[model samples]
Structure formats: C-alpha cells, structure tokens
Target chain A: MPMTIDSSEVLKRIEDAPLLSSSASRLLQITADPEHSLGEVADIVKTDAALTARVLRVVNSAAFGLISTISSIDRAISYLGERLVVGIAIDICASQLFDKPLTGYEAQRGDLWRHDLRVAIASREIARLAPQDMAVDLAFTGGILHDIGKSILSEFLTGTAQSVLETIEKGEAQDYLEAERAMLGIDHAMVGYELARKWQLPEPLQQVIRFHHKPSEADEEHRSLVYAVHLGDIIAMMGGGGTGSDTLQYHMDSAYTDYLDISVEQLTMTLLHVEEEFSKMEASLLDGKDGGT
Target chain B: MSNLILGVGDFGASNSPGDIVKTFALGSCVAVILLDPGTRSVGMVHVALPDSSINRDKAKERPGYFADTGIPMLLKQMSSMGCNVRKLTVKLAGGAQIMDPNNTFNIGKRNILAVKKLLWQHGMGPVAEDIGANYSRTVSVSTNTGEVVLSSPGRPPWKI
Candidate 1:
C-alpha cells in the first residue's frame, strides 16, 4: 500500500532548510535588477569568499577562452556581462546541492553536478539562437536545477531507490514518471515544481521545473520554454556521459516544433550544436587534471 | 536487404544496385537523407548539432555529432562512392521545438534556420520537409521510387 504524502508539507520543509542561503540571495538580487553593475554584483559575490574564488577560477579557465587573465570578481563580471555573471552565480550556488548521492538515480555525488552542468551548457548554447532579451537566464538556471527534485526524492526513497537503479540497469522498459509515481505516489517533476514554488523561484522557472519532463501538459503560453528544456534534457541523456537511473524515454512531441515555427532541419542542426557544446563543456567540467586555471 | 533501416542513434547507407534507406523518430535533431535516383544509391545522416567549430578537438573524436562537420563528411563519403551532388535529391525531417512556451532555448528553431542557411549557401535546398511540430516523426525515403513518407503518433502516415 502506498501512503499519500502532502506535497505542501514537503515544500514547507524544503523552504525552511537554510541551504544555499547566500547564493540564492545573490541570485534574487541580480534577477530583481539586471542593471546592477559588476561592482554591485561582485560585492554580493565577494561576501562568500569561496564562491567568489570559484567564479573567478571558472572565468579565467580555458573554458571561456579569454585572451587575458581575469583576476577579480569585478573584472570577471564586467567581461562576462551581468547576465552571465548571474548565471555563474546560480551555477556555483547549486553546486553544493550535488554533493550528496542520489540513490533513486544511481548518481554518484558528482554525477548530478556533471549532468546539470552539461544541460546548462547545452541550454545556453541553444539560447544563443533565440533573441537576446527572451534568452531568459532562467533557462540555464532551470536546466541546472531541473533535476534537483530527483536528489530530494532519491533521498526520501532511500530503500526503493536501489530497486529503481537495478531496474534501469537491466534495460527494463518503463517510464521514469510512472516508476516514480508507483514508488512514491508522485513524480519528481511535481516534487521539483513544489520545491521551486517553495523556494519562490521565478514563475517561468517554476513552470520549467514542473513541465520539463512533459512540456505538452504545461500551460500553452510557456510551453516552448518547457519544450526547450525537455529537448535539452533528452539531448543530455542521449549524449550520455552520466545519466542517473531514470530510463524512461519520452518521445519528442511534434506540436512543439509547429508551435515554435521550427523545422526538422533546424532541430537536427540544434541537436548537433548542443551535442558539440555538451562535449566541450563535459571535457572542461571533468578536466580536473588540467586544473582549468 | 533492399530496405536499409536507420534506427535511433544509428545511420544507414546503401549503394551499388541502390536500395531504399529509411530512418525513424526525428525530433529537434535533423535527419539528412540523400539519394541518387539514377544510381538508386542512398545515404542518410542524422545529426544533433549545428557547428563543430566550438570544439574542433572533440569534433574529431565524434564527427557524426554535429551538422557543420557531419554534413560535409556525409557528402564527401557519398560523393566518393559515385553519388553525384547534382543528382542527389535531399529530403529533411525533424527539428521540432521540444521545449517550453517561452522558448528560452529555441535550439530546434535555430537549427532549422541554420540548415536552411547552409543549404542555400551550398545550393542544395530541401526538396520536401515535414518539420517543427510538437510531435515526433518517423521519416522514410524509398530509393527505388523516390517516395518520402512521414508518420506521427496516432496519425496515419502521409507522403511528403
């Protein structure tokens, strides 16, 4: 027999937890006002010495391919622009969330981190194709945070998580949502949505968290963004450096292309581009040997 | 033996006597199908990215992953096998926006645009296309008769 857990209660518990407080605060401030200069943003980042160092290290790394070295937060922000800086802030903030293992996902501590970063990179590259303003920093943020609920759910279902992992490893045919629903009575997408709302993430991001796995069910207005993340997630899974235990494959919905006015050639081109981008980012992220600095 | 099927994550080709080459499940990623009606030689390359310039080093490791690199490579391979570019009738499928309403990351749309631009630049426009729907499609091209068909979920298969 399955017990019904109140999502609201779970959400409240997540909200009360003082996790990533400083990083979340910085993101809120940056998103609240994009005009804030590098100095202002840097001030917020500098408050967390460790985060500031990581940000600086990432910018100076070969990943960005800068001709000259970027030594300080202010310089890094100025060069990368406020939007990218905010993106980096969000990335650093969410980095800690991946420290714990996801039992339901068979993901080692760093696996989720790598997967999220790949999705973020792919999503950002994809975003480059859209109009600049509509790019929505939240896309990258959402891409990075989309799987957070998997971690949460995995933590909650410690015992059953192993079974799910075993099933996936055996190449069993099952939808991840169905399996999750069967095991926990609710899917990770819904749990992620609840957590997003509890955290007061932007409305668009909340929608992204809820519908990334099933964009067709999302509200018509934001369906395209949800579809983008969905595509990104699938591409990430297909690229397959490190996917967690979710083996359910969702077919790509054609209506999404019709709605967005994209064509088959375009989707192929984008997937290729995203795959390329993911490969590069994957190498960079895992290039611990080079130290990347 | 006559019908070469391209599975998900797989590519297919046929030459000599010429055979029908078919691929299924195209979404966001574009499937490039090339056929020489005269020789009946057919080849299809399904690529998932636009350009490989962003990471030339990695592209070398996986040339089939990007359109910019993969398309040229496919063309080169076909041409080397006696498939003339002029006789090559091209059909494209896939590139659907599988994302959210806001389209914060409209890679599918961008990819389609890039393919069009590339095709125009190279003087090879797509002859037939059924692309950019919220649905997934399975595309098949018959080298024997040059028939292109697209099938969607719960819907009857249609010719393009």
Candidate 2:
C-alpha cells in the first residue's frame, strides 16, 4: 500500500534536515536574553572563524561606513549589535535553506532570504515604535526564522499551487495557511513549531514561528512581540519582499492594533526605514556572497 | 538595447528606441510609466508611498519613492529629455492591496488615490491602468513601441 503522508511525515523530514551549527545555536540562545552582554555574543563569534570574518566584513561594509577598521570580535559584535550578529550566524548556518528555490511557491532562489531580511528590519523598526517596552532584538530574530517552515513545506506542496490558489479564490479556504492545512493535513506553522522544538529555539521565537500569521494565538506573555513580527511580516510583503505564490495570501490580524498602537503615518515611516535598512543589510551580507550550499 | 530595472524608491528614463524600463514585485507600491510618441522617450518611477511630508530627507534622497515627489520628478525628467508633456501617454501599474482586508493597512488604496491626484494636478491621467488587486505585479514599458505590459505570479504577461 502507498504510504499515507501526514504531519508525522513532515516531522520525520525535519529530523533528517541538517541541524543548526553549535555556534549558530549558541548565538540564538545567548541573544534571546534581554540582558545578553557584548561579551557573551563575542565569545560565540570568536570560536567560529568564518562567522568572525563575515561579521568583521559586514561591520566594515558600506552599510556601517566606519572610518577605522575594527578587527576585534568584541568591537564587531558591539558595533553590529547582537540582533544582526545572530542574523549573520543564522544566514551562514542555513544559507542553503534560506536561499533555496521555493518550487512549490514558484519563488526564485534567494527570495526567502530577501523576504526574511525585510521582515527582520521591519520587525525591529515596529518594535522600536511600540507603546510598551519589548525586546527589539528578539523581534528581529523572530522575523529571520519566522518562515523557515516554508523551506521544508515547499517540497510537499509541489504541483499544488493552482489548487491552493483556486481554493483561496473560491473561499473554500480562508487563506494559504488554511489551504495548506486542508490539503496537506499540516500547515507551515505546525511544521515550523516542530522544527523549533528540534532546534531548541527559545519559547518566544518558537511562538513567533507558529503564530506569526495569527498573533492572537500566541501566549499572552509574548503576544506583543509576536504582534510586532506579525505586522513586520505584513510590512515586508507590502514593501514587495514576499516569497512567491502565497505572498499576500495570509490575512492581516487587525488585533495587532491592540498590541502595537501606531498611526498610519508611523506605519509609512516604518516602511521607509525597512527599505533603507534592507538595502544596506542585503548589500553587506548577501549581495556578493555565494548564497548557495 | 538595455533594460533599466528600477528598484524601490527609484526611477529612470530612456530615449533609446531599443530600451525597456521596468520595476519588479510591486506589492503596495505603484509604478508610473510615461511615453512620448513623438520622441519614443519612456520613463518609469516605482512609487512606494503617498506623500513626502512624512520624511522630507528621504524624499530629497529618493524622490521616486513617493507619489507627491516621484510623479513630479518623472515629469520633470521626461520634459528635460525633450519629450513634450502634451504628447505624453500616461499609464500606471501596480498599487495592490495585498493583505489589508479591514482597510486598516490601506497603503495600496492610498497610493492609487495619491498617484491619480498627482497626475490630475499635472493635467493628465492614466490612459490605461491595472491597479488595486491582491497580488503583486512586475511592470515593463517598451520605449520602441510605447507598449506597457504587466506580469504577475502564475499569470501570463499582458498589455494594458
């Protein structure tokens, strides 16, 4: 008999996928702390030569435009901040997954990375403007890993794009997430949550990965952070940084207004900041670098 | 022959007959295309926002990012290239309402309105447009034939 595929099958595949490097994993854990120090971040980079070089290059890149070259890992981590340091570490560790072609979504290679970068920038920007205090770096980190589920889900979704779209169009499904659940017996969020568990990502980051599309579903303690990433995801898509067929298919939970109180003018400003920061980071990190595995 | 690709907050113009000007993946952003039949001159601006009052510095740095600034700059560039305003054919593409259902995030609608208002202020309007959708778009204009084409994901490129 042909095997019946389900979320278990997707979970099994996640176990087979390459694990995050020990250094990258350590960076994620260290940076998740609101009081994480420059030394803690520097210690992780000091051990990895490739990551150290990339961090130095990015700090000196045209994006920062420092007059003097800083060769020390401590200065580099301090200058770039733990958020971006973590981003670079993740980019190096998962370049293959980040830069892969989302064949099911009909998206090009590097599309996912670009989208994630935009989301990271936008998330950080929104978090800075929120009325309540929150960890902006955590939001940025969440944005980077929010759509990781897509990398694995794409293979299972091959040749299903038209049906998914038609299902959305006909209102048989609420959005792409629902469509994925209806067809595949599992959505990207659940698949991503399972991966987060496997990777041992922080609870807040895991919540962001699962509830980004619907922030209300996240735990109350992390709701605001999740909301920031939710709006950040929307802003990234609005700014034309979406990944393929399901680009704008997800519903924007207006409940975010309850968590993040900001006017339309402020929202527009966030878009500008996202574009500016996205261009700089893309040029520094991924522009000339070989993004392939 | 050259294809001038305009990124967000950017615009370009070409008078060469073999040139094509285009912008990619316009989600909420709008692209204004100007073509002059007399000179075969074409210009394209990828407008990202409605007004420049929000950030004058960004507007100064990249006038092609806002309808209030970008439209005027494109018109000025086309005229400077010796293309006649009266002879210009205005066509607009993009300005899609991607995820906003409650109109809370209505940048696409606002952008469409702003671009139309700006063009009206210039005493012209889009002769043809493909605007206000839930999908993203990539728009291209041919300086050779004054042809405006739009392509979306999973869809064929079509002329407007």
Candidate 3:
C-alpha cells in the first residue's frame, strides 16, 4: 500500500523548515514593491556582507562579459538589477533545497535549479510582453521559487514515479498534480503555499507558488504575472530543462491568452531568447564554475 | 570509446567507430539520428522548433534549432563525411505532448509533423521512432553500429 500522509504532518514539516535569511526575505519583499528603488535594494544588500560579495561575484561573472569588475554594491545592483541579486541571495540561502537530488522525480542534483533558471528567463521574457503594466522582475523571482515545494514533496514521492505515471496513463488521474493528491493526500503546490505562508513571504509570491499551475485561480491583480510564470514553466520544460519524469506533466492553461497578449510567433521568439539567456545564466549561477574576479 | 553530447539546437557527426552522439531531457524537443552503414558514420540534430521562418537570422546561426534548417544541415554534414543520403538510416525520438492534453502550444506535435514533412521533402523518412507521450526522453546513437537507444526516468533503456 502507498504511504498515506496527514496534512497536519506536512504542516509540521513546513513549520520545521528553515527560514529564509533576513536579507533574502527582505529583498523578496522590497523587489515586489514597484515603487522600490535601486538605492533601497542596495541598502538591503549593504546590510548583509555575504550577500554583497555574492552580488559582486555574480555581476563580475563572465555571464555579463563585463570589460571591468564592478566594485560597488550599488553599481552591481544597478547593473544586474534587484531580481538577479535577490536570486543570488535566495540561491545561496536555499542551495540545499534547490540542489537536493529529487529521487522521487528521478531527477539528478542541480536539475531543479537549472529548470527554475530557465523558467525565470522565460517568465521575465513573457512579462516584458504583457499588455498590462507588469513587474517583469517579480515574474523572474516567482519563476525561480515557483517549484520549491517539489524539493520537499520529492522524498515522499520517491520511487513512485512509475506508479504516478501509470495512474495518469490509466485515467485514474487528470495529471501529475492530481496524481500527487490522489496518492499523497496533498500536492506540492499546497505544501509550497504552506511554506510560503510560514516564511511570511509577500502575498503575491505566495499566490504564484500556489497557483502557478492554475493561473485563473489566482487573485485577479496577480493573474497576469501567474500566467507569465505558467507559460514560462512550460517553455522551460519544452526547451528540455525539466526536473525529472514530471517535466511538462502539468497542464498548459490556455486561459493564459486571456491575461497575456503573446502570439505564437512571439512565443517562438521567446523560446529562442530563453535559450540564449539561459546558457549565460546557468554558467554564471551554477556552482563550481569560475565566475572570474 | 567517445561520447558527443548535444544540447538543444546542437548537431554532431562522427565517422570514427565507437563514438556515440547523445542528447538528454527531451521534453517537447525532437532529435533526428542518421547513420550511414557504408562509412560507419553517424549524425544527430536536436530540433526545438518546426519553422525556420520564425527567425531566419537565428536559423543561419544555429541551423540545428529548427527542423527546416536542422535537417538539411545534418544531411550536409553527413554528405561532407562521404555518407550517401539514400543509403543512410534515420530514426526519430521525442516530440511528446508532455502534459498539454489540449495541445495549446502544440509544439511537440508540430515538431514531429514538421520533421516528417521536411524528411519527406528530402525523399527520406525515419526507419524507427519512439515519439509522443507525457514523459521526457534521453536518446543516444552509436557510431560503431548505428544502434539507437532511448531512456527515460525510472525506465530501462530501450532501442528503437
């Protein structure tokens, strides 16, 4: 018999999950605010010496192909922007989670991070094309953290990939998410939502983590942003950057057209752009690669 | 033994025996494998889209990114190595719907069709294939024997 987990047990695990660092959390908070300035983002980075170094390291990394090194935090923040800086901080703080081998999904270590980075690039591209005024950076951040729940839920799902796939193939479930719920009693999205709430993340971020797979269900104000992420996630998987067996297993919400105005041609161009951007970002952000002085 | 791994929009051709051309994590993307028995030469192209008309300039720079461009490029590369097109064996893998039951983007389906249409235009077609489904695939083709194998998570490697 498959292991049956209680919602309370999952909630307890979320409560025990490590908290995001103040710098990372604050960056997430500030960057989501449209009125926030680069100076304010710089100020937050100044408070955390370690994050400052990482910011500089990434900015100077070969990904940017900078002719000269960026020595100041303010310059680094301005050059790379708050979203990437926050991404660096969050990456450092959550390295373990992002890099964990998802045995459940049969994904190798670093697979989750690579998939997220591709989604971030694709999401940011989609946001830039939104008909409404949208915060493209927030979409990038949301894309990075959208599947954080998978890391936690992966263990419980260990060795169940074949069975889950069978359930879907047998018509016992609508999709992977439904299969997850049917077998485990809850899905990764719900677990991620619980973790987001526990971490006191911004409401929009929480909504993205929870409703990215179902954008129409998200609050109206953030529906476009969620749709951007929804398409971004699919594009990432399509480009062959999926985490594991579940890659592209989620439904592509067609309602995204109601929120974003991207045409099929634009989407094809977006996929090409994502391929170009992702190569650079992956080299710079992935661990053990030389970022240069 | 040597391995030449192809990322999305990558192409490779090898005539040396014991060489393997492989690509991993093919979601909606499709890979075309070619083998010439006469020369023991093998080539593969991982195509991400159907039409090169989407971006002519990108097509010029990375011909392996679209089926219209990538197939011809792979054929040219094989010919350059003294392999005859008519005598070459071809196989296809990937182009899965993944989870898009509605085929909203329809990229995977389109990719498969586009590749087939392009091959038909070339007076050739795939001799073996394992295309379409909801899972990702990792594929490899050996230069030594032109053996094509496909593997996915939690599944055994099987030949096409």
Candidate 4:
C-alpha cells in the first residue's frame, strides 16, 4: 500500500528514527541558553561514551586537519570551541538520521548531504556578514538542518515526483510549498519543523526550519536569521547542489533582500565564496565518494 | 582520454578522445558544449550568470562565468583546437530555475538567450540541447562519440 505523506506520517518517521542520545540532547538543549558555558556543554557531552567519540572524531578528522590530538571531550570542546562542539554533537545524530537517498525529493545518494552542507556554509557566511543583525552561530545549525523534513517527506513524494513537480511549477499555486500543502496536504518545511521539535532542537532552529522557505512569514525578532537560512537554501539550490525534483518550484521574493539589506550582487558573490568553500570541503570531506546526481 | 572537470567560470577544449569533459550541479547556470566532428575536439564551459556586465572585474577575471563573455571565449578556444569555427556541433544544457527565490530574475533564461545570440553572431547554431527545467542536470560531452548526455535526479538520462 502506498503511504500517505501527511504530517503525521513524517512525524512518525522522526519518532521512529533513532533518538539522539540523552546526553547529546542535553548538550544541545543548553545551546539555546545565551549564558551556556563551554565547560557546561562539555560536561553534558562527556556523559555518553558514544557522544564523546562522535565529537572527538569530527574534531580530529582531516576535515579539520588539527595539529594536536585530543583525548577528552573537555579537551575537544576547548580546542573546537562551544558552538562548533554543539553543532557537531548534534550532527552526530543528524548524520545518522538524515543520511540516505531521499527518493521522493529525487535526491540520489549523497545529494542531500552536499546540499545541506552547502546551505550550512552559505548561511554561516551570511550570518557572519550580518553579525549585528542576527545570531550567526545558530544560523549555521539552522542552515544545515533546514531541510531535515525532506529526509522524511522525500519518502512520500517518490511516486508523485513528476505530477507533484508539474503541479507546483505549472499550476497556479504560487510555489511548491503551496502546491505541497494543496496537494500532498503537507510540505517539507512543516515536516522539518516537527522533526526539529521532536529532536528537542532549539526553538529558534525549529522556527527557521519551519520558515526557511518563507522568511516573510517568520517573526520580526529573528527574521534576519530566517532570511539568512532562506538565502542559504536558495543559494545552495541555485548551484543545483544536491537537488532533486522540485528545483525550480521555489519562487524568489525580492522582499527578502530588502529585509536583510543585501543586494543581489552581494548575494551572488556570497554564493561564489560558498561554492569555493564547498569545493574545498567536498574535496577533503567527500572526495571520490560522489556518484553525481 | 581523461575527463576534465569544467567548474563555473571555467572553459576547456580538448581534442583527445581519451578526454571526456563534464560539469555537475547546474541550477540557474548553463553548460555549453561545442564539438567539432572533423577535428574530434570538444569544448565545455559552465556559465553561472548571463551577462559579463554583472561585474567587470569578474568578467575580466573569469570569462567562463557569464554567457556574453564565456560563450565567445569558448567558441574561440574550440576553433583554435583545429576545428572549423563555423562547422561545430554546438549542444547546450542546464539553465534550470531550481534555486530562484521568485521568478523575478531568470538567469537560466538569460544564459540560453545570450549563448544563442553569440552563436547567431558567429553564424552557427546548436544542433541539440536539453535545456530549461527546475531540476539540476549533470551534462557531459564525449570527444570519443561527439555525444552529449544530460542526467537529472530520478529521471532517465537522455542524449542531447
């Protein structure tokens, strides 16, 4: 029987997916606190043997090309810094959770990984460029995980790829998100929102996940952050990075640039920088593992 | 025949049959492939923007990034590779709107138009193409067969 890919089913997938270790979850929770300390984050990571290994592995990997060998979680946190530790500890769970070919979205093996990584890098750069306007660190996490729901929703959209895309692109629904809501009764963004909540991610991250595609709908308080991730996702897709069926399905709102006080030229240059970074990361982190989709 | 990768703002021409040049992840960008059957040479360039005027510095620095500058450069290179400039079999793919925020700007459409205009100026035409859709395409050209193949996610690859 074909599975109906409504919100409940996606939520169920998130529920069924491997739960993050309690210790990792706790460490992630403190990241939401403005006053969270590096030691405090380290202490939480140390509770789980597996979490400690995960943090140390990424820090010590050739991706970082570290000079010193770190033996302890505390040492790892001190060396890598707090937000990065938090980002990576959560990534330990994310890599396991979202690592797969999401056929519904037409993503081949490794496509989503590359796409999300590009978005993460793009959003992080945007956040850095606008440090006074938004919380850039959180933007990095939000940028990568913004498409988390696609990991679940992709399963449901598989058989419906052509029709769904046609309806979204040609139909008068304005965009894919609308077509998704109108036709599939759900969209990837909303599903991602539920997954973020289910994983106990920070509320800001959850909101960005839900609103990454629609920055205009996001609250004004962190709209800049939302816009950053939004632009990051768009920029990533602009290069066709890790794309599937619904590529042209998104409609760019010019208002987003006005909201962030950025010009298209700036955005274009930012995309170039991020793409350069992406090539370096792909060369080192994902070299020869690619079967391009 | 080694495959040379064509990154954005890059163009290369090869007469070696061992060379199979290709580029991947084309969204709003376009990949232009020019093949000369007589010389057994192929030239491919991944163009990211439509106009060189987007940035004069960028246009001067990387001619392969824009269609206006890149297309002429690519044609010039393909001709210099022992091919009759007027007799090349030009093929194009990419120009997808996969990542546009709104339809307010269509770089893909602009790229296709610019390339076509340049070809017209040269009194040449593309023999085949697989252009304009919302999906990312990985386009490749084989100097061995003078064939171009376009692949998108979940869909079967088709010859252009």
* lDDT tens digits by residue: candidate 1, A1-293: 12445545555546644355576566654654546555677777778776666667666767667798778778876765554555555555555555567755555676677677667655554555453344445566668777777767766555554455344435562455665676666777887777776667767778888888778888876666776676667666544433444522344554555434444445445545655565555554444224457
Query: What are the chain B TM-scores of all models?
Result: 0.84, 0.96, 0.95, 0.92
Give the per-residue lDDT of model 3 (tens digit) for A139-211: 9999999999888888888889888877777888877899888777788888898888888889888999999
Write the residue-wise lDDT of candidate 3 on B78-137 in tens digits.
998899988888899999874444345778889999999999998899999999876789
For model 4, how does the per-residue alpha-carbon lDDT over A1-293 read when each residue is reduced to its tens digit?
A: 13344566556777776676676578667766667777788778777666676667655666656688667877877866665565556556667645778887776777777787788888877777773656666777787678877877776677766666556546656676776676557888988887777777877888899998878888877788888888788778877775587765676655765656555566567767887777765553432123111
Worst 10 residues of 3 chain B by lDDT: B97-106
Summed over model 4, clashes come to 8
Off by over 4 Å in 1: A1-18, A32-40, A64-67, A81-84, A91-94, A128-133, A157-174, A216-221, A251-253, A279-292, B1-160
Best by DockQ: 3
Which residue runs does candidate 2 get wrong by more than 4 Å?
Answer: A1-5, A287-293, B98-104
* DockQ order of candidates, top first: 3, 2, 4, 1
Off by over 4 Å in 4: A1-7, A35-84, A129-132, A283-293, B1-10, B13-20, B49-81, B98-133, B154-160
**Model 4: how many Å of interface RMSD?**
3.4
Considering TM-score, where higher is better, how would the candidates rank from best to worst?
A: 3, 2, 4, 1
Predictions' DockQ, in order:
0.05, 0.59, 0.65, 0.46
Chain A TM-score per candidate? 0.76, 0.94, 0.96, 0.84
Root-mean-square deviation per candidate: 10.3, 2.7, 1.8, 4.6
